[model samples]
Target chain A: MSGTDDNAIVAARNFVASLPHCRALGMVVEAAGDGVATLSMPYSEALIGDPGTGVIHGGAISALMDTSGGVAVLSHSTGAAMTATMDLRIDYMRAAEPGGRITARAHCRHVTRSVAFVRAEAFDEMPGSGPVAVANGAFALERATDP
Target chain B: MKRPEPIQVVKQRRDAALRALMNGVPYIRFLGIAFDRRGDELTGVLHYDEKLIGNPGLPALHGGATAAFLEVTATMTLCWATLWDDLEAGRIDVATLSASQPTRLPKTIDFTVDYLRSGLPRDAYARARVNRSGRRYASVHVEGWQDNRDRLFAQATGHFLMPPRA
Candidate 1:
C-alpha cells in the first residue's frame, strides 16, 4: 500500500473505532478506497436475537451496513469530513448462518454538492447463498466553511 | 357461569406477557431496551448508555442503535397483536409463554429508516403502529423521540412475514 492508501486505511479505522457501538459490535474495516469500503463483524453470542434459533438480529446487520455506507461516503474522491445518514432502505434476503462472519461492502454511487448516494450489501462468507441483506442509502455531506 | 375478566387483571396479565416476550430476545437485553406497556400500546425505551455513542465528537447516540430500537419496538408490537386473541381467551399467559417459548416473532421482510435528526446522547422512546397485518404479512410504522413526543429524531416503516400459527 502507498502512503496515501495507508493514511486512508488509518483514517477509516479511526473513523470506525470512534463509534463505541461499532466497537462493541466488533466491526473491522477490511479495505477502503475510491468511494468504496468493506467491513466485517464476527459472530458473537450477544448479537443473537432469538435464543432458540440463535440467529443474529436484523438490527445488528443494519447497523453494520449503515456505518459502512457512511464510511464509503467519507472515502469518496471529494471526501467530506463528516456525513450523516439521511435515509436508508434495507431488505433482508435471508438470515445469516450462526458462527460465521458477516461482511458488508458499500459503494458510493453518486455525490452532489450536499448529498451522496450509497448502496451496501451484507453477506456471510458462505459461497452461493448470496447477500443476507442489501441497502440503498442517501447521506448528507458536510463541507469546510470559508475563512 | 364464569365472570368476565376485571380491568386490573387484564392489565397485569398483558404486562407480564409483554415482559416475558421482551426478555426472550437476547439482542433487546444486550441493548438494555425495555418496553413500557399502555392500554393496547407498547413503548420501547432505549436506555442511555455510554457505549451507544456513535459520533464521539458530538457524543450522539449511534444511528444504528436508534434504528435497532425502532425495529425492536415495531416487532414486539406486531407480536403482541398476533397473540392478543389467545391472551384474551386465556389460552396464552406469561407462564405458558416463558415456559414453552411458543411465540415466534415475525421475520422482517424490509425496513426503511428516515433519520429526521441526530440522536442526542440520552434515553430515546419509540412506539409503533401496525399499518397492515393479516394471516402471513404485516407492515408497521414506528417513531422515536427523546424529550418531546412532537419532536422526533427518527422514524421507520417495516414489513414483516408472520410465522405460522401454532
Candidate 2:
C-alpha cells in the first residue's frame, strides 16, 4: 500500500472513533506518514482506578502501544492485519503527570509475507522531554481475499 | 449525587460477568474486577488497593494482572457485541477465545510495555479497546494511567487468533 493512502488512514480512524472507551479517553490519530502513524489519547478522571492518590494504570499504557503498532502495520498492508502479540516486555521510566496528553509514534521496521515488526514511543507533550514509555511489537497480517 | 447501589451488588455482577467471560482463569477472581453496564457497553475496572503492589523497590503492579486486565477487557467487548440478536453469539464464543488465545497458552510469546507515567502512592486506571475483523480474530489495545495524572503509565497491544471450536 502507498504511504499516502488516505483511504486506509480514514478507515482506521473511523474504526477507532467507533469505540466508546476510545472516545471516552479522547484518542485521535494525529497523522500518518511513510509507514509511520502517530496517535494521541487524552487522560480522563473516569479512567483512574484509585481516586485518592493519582496513578495511571499500566493497562491503559498497553492499549496505546497496541493501537500505535497495529496502525503502523495497517498503513503498509493491503488486507487487514490481525496482531497477535507474541511477547511484550515493559520498562516503567516514570509516573505520568495528571491531565496530560499521551502521544505515540509508531513506525514499521520490517514486514514480510505474514509478520510485521514495529516500534513505538509515548510521552507527555506538556513537557515532552523524556519518553514515558517505549515499545517494540510484532504482529501477523492476514491478507484478505476478494470475494 | 447519591451513590448508585450497594457495593456488594456491583461486585456480584462484575464477578458473574468475569466468570462467564473466560474459563480456567483464577486471577480474574483474585483481582476483583468490577463491571459497569451502561446500555450496550460493558465497562470493567480493577480497583487498586494496598495489595496490588508487586515489588517493594519500584512497587510496580504485577505484569500478569495487567495482562489479565487487557485480555478480559477484549473478551468483554466481544461478549457485549454478541448480545445483538442479529449476530450469532456462538461464533463469538469461539471468536472471543481466539481473540485472546495466546500463541502459547499461559505463556507470552512476545510482550512490549511502556511506562508513560507513574502513580504516587496507590491506585491507577486502565482502559482497553478490542477490534475484531469478521469472525476470525481481534486485536486489543490497553492503556494504564496514573489515577490522578492524565499521563499514561503503561500501554500494551495484543493479538489473538480465533478459530472455529473443534
Candidate 3:
C-alpha cells in the first residue's frame, strides 16, 4: 500500500471511531481499503429477537449493514466528510445464529458528486454456508471543499 | 378476556397495552421508544440520547437507530390495530394481552428504508400505516419526522409475518 492509501485507511478508522452508535452496538472496524470496508458486531443478549430460538433480531442485521455502507463511503472518498444514508433495502436470507459474531462487508460500487451507492452482505462465518442478509444502499455525501 | 367497558376505560387499557409493548420488546425497549395514542392512531417517539449519535462530527442520530425506530413503529401499529379489531368483535380484551402474547410481535420478512435527511440530534416521531394485511402477511408503510411531519427524515416499507390466531 502506498502512503496515500495508508492515510485514507487511517482516516476511515478515525471516522469509524467517532460513531457513538457503532460503539453502542459493539461494532468494530475490521478492515478498510479503497471503496471497501468490513465491520463486525459481537453477539449480545440485547440483540436477541426470539427467546426460544436465541436468534438475533432482523433489526440488528439492518443496523450492521447500514453502518457498513456508511463506512464504505468513507473508504471511497478522498477526504472524509459528512455522509448520511439516503436509502437502504435489506433482504433477510436466514436467521443469524446466536453467540456468533456477525460480519458485514460493503463495497462502494458507485459514487457521484452527491450520492454513493453501496452493496453489502452479512454473515456469521464467511467461507461457510452463505450470507445471512444482503443489502443495497445509497448515501448522500456532503463533501468538504478542497483547500 | 373479552369484556366491554366504557370508552375511556377501554382507551386506558389500550394505552397500557402499548406501554407494555414498549417495555417488553428487548430491542425497542432498549431504544426507549414510547407510543403516543390518540383514539385509534399511534405514533412512536424515540427520545434523543447521547448513545444514539452515529456521526459525532455531524452529531446526528444513527441511521440504524432511525431504521429500527421505523420498523418497530410499523410492527407496533399493526399489533395495535389487531387489538382494536379484536375489541370491536368483543372476542378478546386488549387490557389482558401481555408482551408474551403470540400476536404481539410481527416478524419482519422484508424492510426498505429511505432516509431523506440526516437524523439530527432530537426526538424522532414515527407513524405507520398498514397498507395491506392478510391471513399470513402484512405490508406497512412507516414515516419518521423530527421537527416537521411534512418534511420527514425517513420513510420505510416492510412486510411482516402474521402468525395464525389462537
Model 1, residue pairs in steric clash: none
Q: In angstroms, what RMSD does candidate 3 have relative to the true structure?
A: 3.0
Interface root mean square deviation per prediction: 1.1, 14.3, 1.9
lDDT of 2 by residue, A1-147 (tens): 454567767866875565443454467988665567888887766444323234354456556665667677777744544444444554435556767777888888988777777788878765747877677766666666523
lDDT of 3 by residue, B100-159 (tens): 453346778889999888898999999999999988899999999999989999999999
lDDT of each: 0.90, 0.55, 0.82
TM-score of chain A of each: 0.95, 0.81, 0.90
User: What's each prediction's clash count?
Assistant: 0, 53, 0
Candidate 2's docking class is incorrect
- Highest lDDT against the true fold, candidate: 1
Candidate 1 lDDT, tens digit per residue, B82-123? 888888888875788877763588999999999999999999
User: What stretches of model 2 exceed 4 Å from their correct place?
Assistant: A1-5, A49-53, A77-82, B1-166
Task: Write one digit per residue (lDDT tens) for candidate 1, span A14-95.
Answer: 9998889999999999988778999999998888887778889999999999999988888887868899999999999998
Model 3 misplaced stretches (Cα beyond 4 Å): A2-9, A77-80, B1-4, B88-90, B93-96, B99-104
DockQ of candidate 3 against the true complex: 0.63
Q: Write the per-residue lDDT of candidate 2 for residues B1-166, one digit (tens) a residue.
A: 9667677765554444444443333334445565555545565567775444332334445443455465555545554454333222223343343344421121122234443433333555566666543455556666665564357656666554443433
Kindly give the stretch of ten consecutive residues in candidate 3 chain A with the minimal lDDT sum. A74-83
Residue B127 Cα positional deviation in candidate 1, in Å, after optimal superposition: 0.6
Can you write out model 3's per-residue Cα lDDT over A60-147, one digit (the tens) per residue? 7888899888888877855447678889998877778788999999999888888898999999964677999899998888778734
lDDT of 3 at A30: 83
